[model samples]
Target: MRINKFIANSGFTSRRKADDLIIQGRVKINGQTIYEPGIQVVDGDKVEVEGKLLTIEKKFYIKLYKPVGFITSNFDPYNELDLNDLLDIDKRFFAAGRLDKDSEGLLIITNDGEFTNNLIHPKFKLDKEYIVKIDRKLRASQEKKFEKGLDIGNGEKTSDAKLEYLGNNTYSVIIHQGFNRQIRRMFKVLGARVIELKRIRIGKIFLGDLKEKEYKYFSKDELKFVDEMIR
Candidate 1:
C-alpha cells in the first residue's frame, strides 16, 4: 500500500496528514525517513510516524446528534463540554468536519482518513445542509444575493447556494463548501445575525429524529452512500 494510505489505514490520521508527516521527515520506513507519498510498503515492512509504530485498527463510522454548548474538538484546555466527552465509543474517532461550540446538530465521526479527506476536500464539493435562525427575517433581495454568492471579506466569496424559507425567521440552506463560520458570515453581510445554526444533513445522511447528544453506528446503506459520494 502507499505510505499515506498505510498511515491512514493505521488510524493515526488522514492520508493528507500522513503526506504532511512524510514531508516533515516525521515518517520513517524501516528506520529511514520516507518522503515519497506513492512509495509502497509491504506487510512485513515497519512503518512509523513520529517514532510511533503504525498499526491498523477497525474503522468506525459514527453519527452523533450534537447539541448546543458542546464543542467539536479533540481537546479543550478550559475543561468545557466537548463532543468526545458525549461519546461512549471505545476507539478514538475524529470528526470529519466541525461545528462551532455554539452551533450544534449532526456530526460525522470516523477513523477512515480517506473518507474524511474526500468529504472535506475542495475537489469533491460535498453538500452540507443547515437550518438557521437569523435575528430577523431575510428579504428576497438578500436571498438572491446569497444564491448568487456573498463576499465575506478577506478576498473570499461564497459559492452558489440553495436557500429556502422555513417560516418565521428560520431558513434552510445548502452549500457545497465547508467554509469556516460560513453561514454566519453570509447572514452578517446582509445585516442579520445568525442566532441559531444546526447542521441537519451531510451528503445523503440526515439527522432525522436523532436526539441531541446521542449517537449511532452508521448503517451499511449509509456507508455505501459515503463511498459513492467520494467516487
Candidate 2:
C-alpha cells in the first residue's frame, strides 16, 4: 500500500495530511526519510511518522456536542482545557474538523483517519451549517455578501455560503470551507460581533438534541449514511 495510506491506517490523521508529512520530510520508511507519498509498504517493513511507529486497527467514531470554552485539540498547553476530559471513553480519538474555543456545537470525533479526510476534503463539498447570533439583526445586503463569499481580510476570503434568516439576531449559514475562525471573521468583516455560534449539522448528521459536552457513538444507520456520502 501507499505510504500515505499506511500512515492513515495508523489512525494518526487523514491520508491527505500524511501526504503533507511526506512532503515535509517528516515520514520515514525503515529509518530512511521518504518524500514520496506513493512509496510501497510491505509486511515487515518499518514505518514511522514524526518518530512514532505506525499500525492499523479498528476505528471508533463519535458525535459530540462541543461546548464553548473547550478546545478540539487532543491537549492544550495553555488554559489546561482538554476535550477528552469531557468524555469517559478510553480510546484515543481526534476531532475530524474544528470549532474555535468560543464556538459550540456538533463536532465529529473519530479514530477513522479516512473519515477525517472525507469530512474536510475540498472535493467532498459537505456543508457545515451553523446558527449564528450577532449583537444585532443582520441586514439583507450582508446576506448577499455571504452568498457571494466575504473578504475576511488579510488576503483570506470566505467560500460561498448559503444563508437563511432565522429571524431576529440569528441566521443559519452553511459553508463548505473550513478556514480558521471563518464565520466569526466574516461577521467581523461585516462590522458586527457574533454573540454565539453553534454548528447544527454536518452533511446528513445533525447535532440533534445533544446537550453541551454530551456524546454518543454513531449508530449503524448514521454510519451507513456517512459511508455512502463519503463513498
Candidate 3:
C-alpha cells in the first residue's frame, strides 16, 4: 500500500493528513525518514509516523450526540472534558469532524481514515445541517445576506448556505463549507450571536433519538448509505 494510505489504515488520521505528515518528514520506513507520500510498503516492512509504529487496526464507525463543554480531540492539553471518555470500547476513534466546545450535537466517531476524509473534505461538498439558536430573531435582510454568503473574516467568504427560519429565535442552517467555527462566524458577521448550535444531520445520517452524551454504532444500512454517498 502507499505510505500515506498505510498511515491512514493505522488509524492515525485521514489520508490527506497522512500525506502532510509524510511531507513534514515525520514518517519513517524502517528507521529512514521519508518525505515521499507515495512510497510503497509491503508485508514485514516497518512503518512509523511521528516516531510511533503504525499498525492496521479494525475500523469502527459510531454516532455520538456530543454535549456542550466537551472537546472533540483526544489530546486535551488544557484538561477539558473529552468525548473519547464517553466510549468505553477498546478501539480508539476520532471525530470525523469537529464541533466547538460550546456546540452540542451529532458527531461521527470512526477509526476509518478514508471515511473521515470523505465526510469532511471540501471536495465532497457534503451538506451538514445544524439547528442554531441566536441571541435575537433573524431579520429578512440578514437571512438573505446569509444565504448569499458573507465575509466571515481572514479574507475568507463562506459559500452560499441555506437558512430556514424555525421561529423562536432558532433557524435551520445548512452549510457545505467546513470553516473554523463557521456557523458562529457567519452569524457574527451579521451582528448576531449564536447562543446554541446543534448539528442534526450530515448527509443522510441523523442524530435521531440519541440523547445528550449517547452513542451507538452505525447500522449496516446506515454504513451502506454513507458508502454510497461518498462514492
**Inter-residue clash pairs, candidate 2:** none
Q: Model 3 clash pairs?
A: none
Model 1: lDDT to the true structure: 0.87
If the candidates were sorted by their lDDT against the true structure, best first, what order would they fall in? Answer: 3, 1, 2
TM-score of each: 0.87, 0.81, 0.81
**Which of 1 and 3 is ahead in TM-score?**
1
- In candidate 1, what are the lDDT values of residues 1-231, reduced to their tens digit? 899888988878877788899998899999999888999999799998999998888788888998998888767899999866889777777899988888989999987877887888878778899999999988899999999999998878999999999988999999988778889999999999999999999988888889988888889889897668435
Q: What is the C-alpha lDDT of each candidate?
A: 0.87, 0.86, 0.88
Candidate 3: C-alpha lDDT? 0.88
Using TM-score as the yardstick, the better of models 1 and 2 is 1
Q: lDDT score, residue 138, model 3?
A: 74
Any residue pairs clashing in model 1, and if so which?
none
User: In model 1, which range of ten residues has the least summed lDDT?
Assistant: 222-231
Query: What is the per-residue lDDT of model 3 for residues 131-196, given as tens digits with 9 covering 90 to 100?
Result: 999999878998999999999889889988999999899999999988889999999988899999
